[model samples]
Target: MPLVRIKSLPFDHEVPVPQVISALSQAISDAANIEQQHIMVTWEYLAQSHYSHHGQVAANQPINTHPLLIDLIAPNFNTEKQIASMLELIAHTIAEQVPIAKNNIFINFTPAYSDGVYDEGHIVEWDM
Candidate 1:
């Protein structure tokens, strides 16, 4: 499973949050060759007053100045190519949905050991 967390300023009224989430989840699943049901996505909106870049608050900067941060946590089994594809897919997916530039979207991939993940009341085993 890949758990994706996206943090950004609130999207415009024209952008539906649920649609973005669904698209991101589907992209990750396709990139990783995993079932869509195994992918988890969460979005957190940061208030413009609370977000900053180079000490300038988002409210004071031009629109889309603040970057969109994405955290992708997954098992440590994917190849480098897979990781690259996932990052590309994620950035493109968000850029298409939101007004942010593709360059402003930053995705951080964190690898977790199979034994470290807990689900369904027990630790996950990749080999199982």
Candidate 2:
């Protein structure tokens, strides 16, 4: 359930996605004290001028010249304080590319019951 998803801003500048991923993996692993194997991270780009969701600016957005969208998902649930901390860990991973405006980033943590999710199209673990 500890998954880190990172999506970069839609900029022509080729972000060292691999380097950034390593940094994120390290940060999240340290913060959660968990192995890197359980973590999942991804990066996607969105043009500032051409991207808008629900008539509103999307999360992990760029407010200026097409900022990058960086998202980190963990096995956390409920409350802004928790989300904020997780975002900080993730933001620290790519702090070089993102500013600490608090509004420039977004984070989510959903605790999925292992039973609710599947592996190889089978409910691997549903017993308590």
Which parts of model 2 are misplaced by more than 4 Å?
Answer: 47-49, 53-73, 76-84, 97-102, 119-128
lDDT of 1 by residue, 34-110 (tens): 89878999998877578878787764223457788899888788888887888889888888887778888879999
Q: Residue 93's C-alpha lDDT in candidate 2?
A: 57
lDDT of 1 at 88: 88
**What is the C-alpha local distance difference test score of candidate 1?**
0.81
- The candidate 1 region of ten consecutive residues with least summed lDDT is 56-65
Best-fitting candidate, scored by TM-score: 1
Give the CA lDDT, 0 to 100, for residue 72 in model 2: 47
lDDT value, candidate 2, whole model: 0.57
TM-score of candidate 2 versus the correct structure, residues matched by position: 0.62
